[model samples]
Target chain A: MIKARVTVTLKNGVLDPQGKAIENSLGSLGFKGVGSVRQGKVFDVSLDVKDEATAKHDIESMCEKLLANTVIEDYQVEIV
Target chain B: MIKARVTVTLKNGVLDPQGKAIENSLGSLGFKGVGSVRQGKVFDVSLDVKDEATAKHDIESMCEKLLANTVIEDYQVEIV
Candidate 1:
């Protein structure tokens, strides 16, 4: 068994409302030093593949197909 | 300047619909080895501060105040 981890985040040019909301919430809670917040997603996946090559191939397809929205988000994958 | 990174994830009990959808998408893409996906969040924050102690304190405050929902998500912070 292998572990495939993927992280997805909004592209640099995209607006992140969820992150902004969190930033606003922080100010109200008295954390005055915060300037901004950017939110991203992480996925820890378990795979039952036999070798590294197959694992990489499958994971890449997974990321491209479902783990990220190519239009607005970017993704990175790590195998362990 | 110091860098603070925070990772937030749903507690073990919460349902992760985004992850589930990704898993299904992977299966349809012909990557049958995938079993489960647990989704999490990551935040990279930059702060102008001195000393590890103060940075830790402020980062903790940020996590508790805005980075995590507390009710459904847990968080961890790294200072660099």
Candidate 2:
């Protein structure tokens, strides 16, 4: 079995309201050094896959098809 | 300048409602292989530090002070 990690984040031109909200909250909590927050999603997946190539293919398909919204989000995957 | 990565995830005991929502959404999108989804946060920070020790201290302070909710989350950091 292999462990796969996937990260999804908003595209550069997109606005992230959730990230802004967190930034505001952090400032209110006395975190004065914080400048901004860009929230993203992380996933840890366990797969019964054999090699890195096949796993990458399957994971990329997963990200493109369902895990991320290609219009406003970008994704990266790491297998270990 | 150095780059630091901070990842925060739900404590093992806590329930992750957002993760469940994403899982359901993926299933609806026809991703048959997806079994579960656990959501986490990642922060990429650029710092003007010279060494790893100070960076580690400052980053850990950031995590404890603002980046993560210690009551419900655990965090890990990587300096690059």
Candidate 3:
């Protein structure tokens, strides 16, 4: 079995309201010197595949098909 | 300027409905050999603090206070 981690993040130019909310909340809670709180998603998947190459390929395909919204979010797949 | 990444994941044995939904969706989408689709949150934060120790400390505090639910989720903080 192979393990892979997929991280999906918003595009640089996209506005992240959730992140903005967190930043404001942090400030209200007295955490200073903090800025640019961008939120993203992580997926830890266990694969029954054999090789690293196949695992990466399948995971990338999964991101493209279902895991990530390619229009505004970018995804990175790493085999661990 | 310092940069940090905080990853929050459900603790073992915690119920993760969103993850289960994704797992089932993956199977429905024709991705085979996939199991244990655990989902999580990632926060990319930029800090105006100096030094790694202070940054790490502050980030950890953020996790404890806001980013994670201490009862059910575990968070990892890294200065990157």
Candidate 4:
């Protein structure tokens, strides 16, 4: 079994209200000197397939087709 | 300046409804042989702090206090 970790993050210049809220909250909590906070998604998938190359390709395809909205977000796949 | 990427994931044995939904969606989209899908959170934080040691300590504190619930979730911080 191969496990793939996918991280999907919003592209630069996109408005992230949740991240902003978290930033503000951190400020309130006395965490100073914090610049920008961008919140994203993480997907941990276990595959029954064995080949590393095939797993990487399939997961990337998954990210492109369904997991991430390529117009607004970028995804990186790490196989472990 | 330092950038910290924090990944927060649920502990094993915890029920992840969102992950389950995504898994089902993938099956509907004709992607088979997928075993388990676990969903998590990603936070991209930019800090104005200079010292690597302070940055690491501060970020870990931030994760414990706000970014993740340690009782059910585990978080890893990566400095990049």
How large is the C-alpha RMSD of every model relative to the true structure? Answer: 2.2, 3.0, 0.6, 0.8
Candidates in order have lDDT scores of 0.81, 0.77, 0.94, 0.93
Any runs in candidate 2 off by more than 4 Å, and if so which? A11-38, A48-52
**Which 10-residue span in candidate 3 chain B carries the lowest summed lDDT?**
B27-36
Better of 3 and 4 by lDDT: 3
lDDT of candidate model 1 versus the reference: 0.81
What TM-score does chain B get in every candidate?
A: 0.92, 0.93, 0.97, 0.96
Q: Which of the two candidates, 1 or 4, achieves a greater TM-score against the reference?
A: 4
Q: Give the per-residue lDDT digits (tens) of candidate 2, residues A1-80.
A: 66788988888869988868766776676544555567787887655566778778877887888778999999999985
Q: A41, model 3: CA deviation in Å?
A: 0.3
Residue-level lDDT of model 2, residues B1-80, one tens digit each, is: 66677889899878988878877876676655555667898876655566778777877987898888999999998975
| TM-score, prediction 2 | 0.76
Model 3 C-alpha lDDT per residue in residues B1-80, reported as the tens digit of each score: 89999999999999999999999999999999997899999999999998999999999999999999989999999889
Candidate 4's TM-score on the B chain: 0.96
lDDT of 1 by residue, A1-80 (tens): 88877878899979998878877777788765666677888888988989877888887777787778989999888886
Q: Give Cα distance to truth, residue A27, candidate 4, Å.
A: 0.5
Between candidates 2 and 3, name the one with more favorable lDDT. 3
- Interface RMSD (Å), every candidate: 1.6, 3.0, 0.6, 0.7
Compose the digit string of candidate 3's lDDT tens values, residues A4-55. Answer: 9999999999999999999999999999999779999999999998899999
